[model samples]
Target: MSTSYDITQDKWERFTFSREGRVLTAAITSDHPVNGVDEQMHTELALVFNCLQRDSESDIIILTAKGRAFCAGGDFDWFEEQINHPERFRAIGWDAKQIVTTLLNMEKPILCRMNGAAAGLGATIALLCDIIIADETAKIGDPHVKVGLVAGDGGALIWPQLIGFAKAKELLMTGDLLTAKEAERIGLINYAVPAAELDAKVAELVAKLQANPKWAVRWTKTTANIPLRALAAQLMDASIGWESVSNYLGDRREAVAAFKEKRAPKLTGE
Candidate 1:
């Protein structure tokens, strides 16, 4: 008799999980206007990966979102709260570390179904996946610096490893967005297909992974992740610390205020 791993029992307010055979799809289902990350979503993101990793029935995991954008970075309202309350931002440092470490530690293969724009932490999550198949129209980038914050939440760790340090430094420093096609060309992502073909392409890749020997595929992913895991361990705490420190900086406050006023941020670089 097969042991059942009922994913429905995994109660998550911001995420929904559904399984098709041994392949599970975990989607971000936030109701924010842009499906942005808030306090609840951030906490859930840190916890949900562990739950998915524990699901014995799922051999492959697909990370995606329900709406147009995968995740449109951090919610502005939440950003405001963090700016006003240093303790609140500092409190989430553990969750930030957990999100990166748990993801790197997972043995199962993960595929990102990039339905639309994925910026900042959203970009970090998608990039951390083992295989990323993005819609041609989708955009991906870590624009933490744009808001005067550090891209310490796995962005710094993964980008350099994926596309090399030189290009990674340029993008992270500038906080520029890249077309999915450009991402693929730069080897930052695996495939960029037409919007209409995104689902079909993801399904094809899932089938290919399922056809391989289960342990071999899982262990191969684990083996490949060893270096990444080490890097994450060394860098996550310090990066998250810097991001927290940034929340109290004048530049971050100005960035948020300018965003609300729909004007340019005159960052003093303080």
Candidate 2:
């Protein structure tokens, strides 16, 4: 059988296959305190997905990080670059969207092991996973609104579906960090286990999946995802457009500035 994932290194990340059959792993190493999906990370993720797709033997993917935080979301430097290059911003937005879509449509099961704090796009991807197992101590939230962006990507689409619109709206609007246990209670995550037990739990789940008929498993996932796929195809663009436009608005400008200043954001009618 072909290897699950060919090990590779980029400037700030690494990709490899787990010993378990059909499981892929990505390890990101950044000098910063937390990892951010900058342009380079986006390119690496795209390549990783393509590589995983080409390897027909692969049947499962587990995305985990190696720091105190899973991902801190966008790189400010990259964001600044996008601000300077609006065309590039649009292209990057579409590219990032493609990455999420690819994961959603992958033939194999996708499990997200949220080992640590997950925010913004990190939280978005975690929610999109077929299974989400979080470290009991982890906190997950969408801080996009805190930064003046609409909770685009999968946040607006999945949160409401998973937890109902009322709760989703409150959390997304407030940017509150939900504890893992709380996350599970709200149906935001599958399970919250001790930090040490996280990997083992994921392995157990994967084993269960691996033991099942691959075709049947894949078909079940594909069928269940059809609704999510349709929802995304229908609403993702409008949500992203709203988010992108929000970036240029006075409220978002103040939001980012407040974040930088470590102060509560004050919004004024614009």
For residues 35-145, could you state the per-residue lDDT of candidate 2 as single tens digits? 777877777665665565555556777878878877778777676566556577677677667766777777678888888888888888788888999999989999888
By TM-score, who's the top model here?
Answer: 1
All candidates: CA RMSD in angstroms?
Answer: 1.6, 2.8
- Candidate 2 ranges beyond 4 A from true positions: 1-17
TM-score for each predicted model, relative to the true structure: 0.97, 0.89
Stretches > 4 Å off in candidate 1 = 1-4
Roughly what TM-score does model 1 have, to 2 decimal places? Answer: 0.97
List pairs with backbone clashes in candidate 2.
none
Count residue pairs with overlapping backbones in model 2.
0
